[model samples]
Target: MVFMGIDIGSTTSKGVLMNEEQAILAQHLVHAGIGTSGPAAVKKELLAAAGLQDEDIDYTVVTGYGRRTYAEADSQVSELSCHAKGSAFLFPDVRMVIDIGGQDAKVIRLDSHGRMTDFVMNDKCAAGTGRFLEVMAGILQMDVSELEQEAAKATQTLRISSTCTVFAESEVISQLAAGAEIPALVKGICGSVASRTAGLVRRMGVEEKVCMSGGVANNGAVRRAMEEELGTEILYSPLAQFAGALGAALYAMEKAGKEKEHE
Candidate 1:
């Protein structure tokens, strides 16, 4: 049977297709997310990639911030649950997960059986999120993707005192005007985000074999800074951004199997 999962996040949408054996058939990511064309775009591209149509999918599950509004899903799941499942699937020994998305950051702890034990989220502010980095990169007149390369060249790390996005932006500007090196400032920006996220991780209690999910996990500079702040290696996959979608697809597969058994 064919199963599908879609994660409609704040700034991106991800989709995954799988078969009865749980083998991934296709995966797609769209830059636009909920309330935009992201969800529809992911569905179309994912189906086309797998050489299948919507009706061919035996089950469809949705997760993420926009899951409730997505009418095409057969069911909806919470991002927290989905992330836990996805991270465990990717790293079977993972005991902790840190997901930094566009607008928020979350730290989740899992039991030995891969069940979620505790989680802490920073949904109230934009600091320490992908949006925060994007804003900082913009002020530096550079693309967000260049942050890692720039940060790598830093000779020293400047400390950004403000944890608020607006205030941090002002701090960056002030430092730039004062002849601060851009690379050092970039490293500092990443360090600031790491420090804030580390606080959340500490609140939930750090565990070994920590894995990182979400778009920010793709940022090498931020990941390095996070590893240093937490004093542990953060494991991540190239498919990190799709973890939520993959987890939802796994749920779809399970649901499909159960329905067939009942029939």
Candidate 2:
């Protein structure tokens, strides 16, 4: 049977199609433009990529910043729950999930059975999130993907004192004027973001076999910062960015099976 999942984040929207085994069949990622047309536009693009019309889906699960944005979905779910479900589906041993989205960051705790026990998030701040890194990237004239590799080449530690994006930008300018090494400054900025992320994860309580999800999970600098602060290893998924969508798909599949069983 086929299942579909849609994640409507602030910066990006992702849609996925999968089978009962959770094997991904097709997926699409698109920039989420400003306005009220979040899920509708994203779903249309995803449906096109999957080579199936929207009605062909067995069930559809929606999640992320715009969970309610997908009014046509069979069900709307939270990003935290979706990440837990999706990560566990891929890695059954996962006891923790760290997800960094465009505007928020979350760390979810799960039981041995993969049920969510508790979670913590920083939805109000950009300090520990992808947005923080994006601003830093702009200041450093570098991309997040390259930040970690550069950080690894740093010869000294550079300090950044501001947590606010605006203040941080000012501090970066001062650092540049002081002739701070570009690599060192970039490393410090990433370190600050990771430190904030570690703080959120601490609220959820650290556990083994942690899985990292969301688009920012693709960043090595963020991963290194998180691991350093948390003092634990992180497992990365190639499909990290689609965790919410994958979770939705899996949930839709299960719900469909139960419906059929009753019939």
Candidate 3:
């Protein structure tokens, strides 16, 4: 049977389809574009991925910042739960999950079975989120994908004084003029974000076997920075961007199977 999961975030939407055995049949990521268009667009892409329409889906679940947008979902779950579920699948022993999205970041502590125990989230600021990195990359006349690599090469410690993206860019410029190496400046930015996220994770008493998910998780700099701050290697989900969707889909499968068994 075809089970689907959809994660509609501020900047992107991801969808995934899995079979009864939990094999991923297809996955797709699309820009959110405008308003609820992200989920709507993801729905279209999901249909295209499976070569079938919405009705063909045996079950559908939605999660993410815009989870509420998919009112027709079989269920709408918190991103923390979805992240934990997804992380556990990727790293069966993961007890900590850090997910950095465009507008928000989350640190979820999970039990041995991957169920969430507690979590903290940062949604009020862009300091350490994907949006901050993207905005800073733009100001530096560079691509967001290239930002992490540059940040990873710092030879000296560069301090980023501003938590705000706008102010950070101005600080970066000032540092650049002061003979701060490009790598140092880049590292500073990554370090700033890593520090912010690490603070929250530390407060929760994070454990090893950590897994990170989200589009930001794709950034090598960000991952390394997080690792340095945590002093451990973080596990990666093959489908980082689609973790929320994959979790939702997996949950949908369980729900569907339970319903079938009862009938």
Candidate 4:
């Protein structure tokens, strides 16, 4: 039987389909617009990718910021639990997970068995999040993807002292007005994000074998800066964005098994 998981994040929606053996069959991710249309968008895409129909799915679990609002899921799970479970599945040695999404950031501490033991989250502000980077990129008149390339070209890193997004934007503007090199400014922005995230990681106490999950994990500059701040190597995967969905899929598989046992 096929089980499914959908992660409706603030900025994107992701879906994963898995078989009884918990092997991934297909996955889908899409930008979420302002409203609640994300889950529906990814559901159609994921089902098509897996060559299956909605009726073919035996179980479903929904996760992420919009989980409770999703009507199609048989149940819902916390993104924290999902991230921990997903990180463990991908990196068995991972004892910590740093998930920086569009509008928020989270650091999850996991046990050796992959269970979430503790977590710290920053949802009150957009600072140090993917949104913060996007805003900086906009101020720089550059694309989000260009931040890494620009930082790579920097000969020396500049410091951005503000942690508030608005203040940081003001700093960027002032630096630009002063004719500061764009590459150095980009590196500064990345470093500020890393500093903020590293503080969160330190809250739960740093652990070896840290894995990064979420869209921000794809940013090389931020990753490198974070590694430097934390003084530890980070493990990342191309599937970083799908970690929550994968974890939900794993949960769906277990739910399916419980149903079968009852039958």
Candidate 5:
């Protein structure tokens, strides 16, 4: 049977299709998220890619910021638990997970069994999130995707001491006006995000074999900075952004199997 999982995040929607064997069949990501057309688009694309229709899916699970709003899901799970499960699936030895999404950041500590032991989250502000990077990218007149390349050219790292998004914006602008190199400024912006996120990680205590998930994990500069700040190598997968969705799908598979057993 096919099981599906969808993650409706603040800035993106991701879906995964899997079977009883736990092999992924297809994965899709939409740039638009909840309150937009992202949910429908991701589901439609995922089904098409897997050569299946919605009715073929035995069970559906949802997670992320907009999970509760998605009516098609058979069940819903918290993103924190989902992240831990997915990260463990990707890196069986992973003991920690750092997920930086559009508007929030999370640090989850997992035991050897892949169960979540503790987690710290920052949902109160946009200081260490993908949204913050988007704003910084806008102010720098470059796309978010360009940040890594630009940051790599930096001769030195500049300091952005503010943890408030507004203050950081003002500081970046001020530095630009003061003739600070854009690359250096970009590196500083990434560093600021890393530093802030690192604080969250420290709250639960650092552990070995850390994996990063979510859209921001795609940012190499941020990952490098995170590694530096935490003093450990960070692991990530091309499927990093789909970690939550994949975890949800795994849950769906398990639930579906239980139903079959009961039948």
Candidate 6:
């Protein structure tokens, strides 16, 4: 049987398909635009990409901030749970998961068996999330992907003291007006984001085998800064961005199995 998971996030939508054995078959990610339309569109795209029709799926699970709006899902799960589950599947020994998506960040603690034990989330603002980086990128006239590379070239360290997105943008503007080096300024921005994320991780209490997931985990500069601040080697999967979706797929598989057992 085929199982599917969909994550409708604030800034992106992701989908994953799993076979009866819970092995991933295909996964897809796309920018989440206005409302529920983005995830609905992504779900169709993933079904097409996997060469399967909606009828082929045995169960469908939905997750993330917009989970409730997805009328087609057989069930809905929390992003926090899905993230921890996905991180555990990728990194078997992972005791911690730090997920930074478009508008919020999460720190999840896991037990030895990969079950979520505790978690803390920062959903109040965009300061420590991908949106923050995008704002900084706009100020520097650089693409979000270029921020990490530019920060990597830094020869001097600069500190971005503001945790508020508005203030931080103003800070970047002021630095740019003063003819500050772009690379150093970018490094500072990455550092600031890392610091904010690290604070959340600290609140959850660090453990061995730390793993990072979500869109921000794709940024090399932010990952490096997080590693330094947390004083641990972090594990990342190429599947980071799709972790929540993958977790949802796994849950679908589990639910299907239980139904079969009862039958």
Report every candidate's CA lDDT.
0.92, 0.82, 0.83, 0.90, 0.93, 0.89
> Which candidate wins on lDDT?
5
**In candidate 4, what are the lDDT values of residues 19-120, reduced to their tens digit?**
987789999888882266778989899889888888999999998988888887999999888988888999999999999988889999988888888999
Clashing pairs in 4: none
Task: Report the alpha-carbon TM-score of model 3 versus the true structure.
Answer: 0.92
Scanning candidate 6 in windows of ten residues, the lowest lDDT window is 32-41
Clashing pairs in 3: none
* Candidate 5 structure quality by residue, lDDT tens digits, 154-231: 999998963899999999999999999999999999999999999999988899999999999999999999999999
**Cα lDDT of model 2 overall?**
0.82
Q: Candidate 6 has what TM-score? A: 0.96
Cα TM-score per model:
0.97, 0.91, 0.92, 0.96, 0.98, 0.96
User: Can you tell me which runs of candidate 3 are displaced by over 4 Å?
Assistant: 33-36, 261-263
Looking at model 2, report the run of 10 residues with the lowest lDDT sum. Answer: 33-42
| Residue-wise C-alpha lDDT for candidate 2, range 1-263, written one tens digit per residue | 77888888888888888988778888777767224565676677767777778678788888888877577788888888889999998789999999988888888998999999998888587777888878888877886678778888888767665367778888989999988998899878877877878878887678998889998888777788778889999999888998888888888888888888999
> How many backbone clashes does every candidate have?
0, 0, 0, 0, 0, 0
Give candidate 2 misplaced runs (Cα > 4 Å). 33-45
Model 3: per-residue lDDT, tens digit, 1-263? 89988888888988888889999888888876226566777778767877887788898888888887678788777777887897788788888999999888999988877888899998598888988888777767888788777876677868785367778878988887787788787777877788888888898887988888999888877788789999999887668878888898988898899889999
The worst-scoring run of ten residues by lDDT in candidate 1 lies at 160-169
**Model 1: colliding residue pairs:** none
The worst-scoring run of ten residues by lDDT in candidate 5 lies at 159-168
